[model samples]
Target: MAFEDVVVGEARPYADKVVIEEYDPSWPDRYRALADQLHAVLGDTLRLVAHKGSTSVPGLAAKPIIDLVAAVTDSAAEPSYVPALEAVGYRLRVREPDWYQHRMLRKRIVDGADENAHLHVYTEGCPEIAKNLAFRDWLRAHPEDRDRYAEVKRELAKREWRYVQDYAEAKTEIIEDIIAKARAAGVEVPA
Candidate 1:
């Protein structure tokens, strides 16, 4: 099913679960190590690779997942990068061509525990890339926004959710608000 087909609160037999964790100082180091591995695998195929999400922020609470956005020449061309990524334990989980041709890869679980990392692949210049980067920066620079977002996330995390995407979509309002503020303040949007 496409992203649009995912309804909020609709339970599925097998849905991706989420786990929010306290902000950890080691997150950056973890991201660096994972990015290094990815770089070694992806080499020059990635146009841009960055750590996004609240985990990337200094004090923001997050799901303990290192959200990395990698802009590829063409995410639709999964064959170009999927094999290399899989060879190193990354498994392509979601392929949504309907949504900016986005592709999500999760690191294979070592045992029963989650891999704690997700890599989102997008075509160069995808608008979602800018929005994610902008929100991450905005939260980093504004303590008030960061704290507020953290509160909202913590509150939302407490409730039962069908799919992780539903929990994510629930944050759209606050995300849009921050993006709107960024736009008003002359922040650049991805072209």
Candidate 2:
């Protein structure tokens, strides 16, 4: 199926089934360790090392993966940072110049292995980061909404998908809608 064809309502069957382990209280520690590793390599090139996505939200059921957002001041000028990140096990996966010039890298389990964690690098003050963080925070505050999302994800994991990215894009609509509610409630949408 095409990327846009994967919606939360329809793509539930194709997502990989991930057992919802008990919310790890140590997720913060994980983020800190990972963040330190990132900072050690990038140093001044790193603008922010934020714990983002479902893992960053307490009480949320995540796929045992830490999602990080690293903001750089200027992506075009920071070519060295990409190679630096690659040296530390992060492989560039997605580059979207049209979408806020966003760049994404994923940490592989081993050489030529599937990704275990995702690091999203963007120019400092990128609007996408705000929306992402806001969505996570909003879900943390709303258990019913969070539960609903978890249900969709769990169901989606049972289906068949050509690529994992397709499964992720499927959740975009619900995510965007929840983000809208978050913005309406004055949850601090970053400019």
CA lDDT scores, all candidates in order: 0.81, 0.75
- Cα error of candidate 2 at position 21, Å: 4.5
Tens digit of lDDT per residue, candidate 2, span 17-48? Answer: 44455468888788888899888999988989
Per-residue error for 12 in candidate 2, Å, reads 20
Sliding window of 10 residues with minimal summed lDDT for model 2: 6-15
What is candidate 1's lDDT per residue for 96-155, written digit by digit as tens?
A: 777899888877465333456889899998999987898899889999989988888888
What's the distance in Å from true for residue 157, model 2? 1.2
Off by over 4 Å in 2: 1-22, 112-115
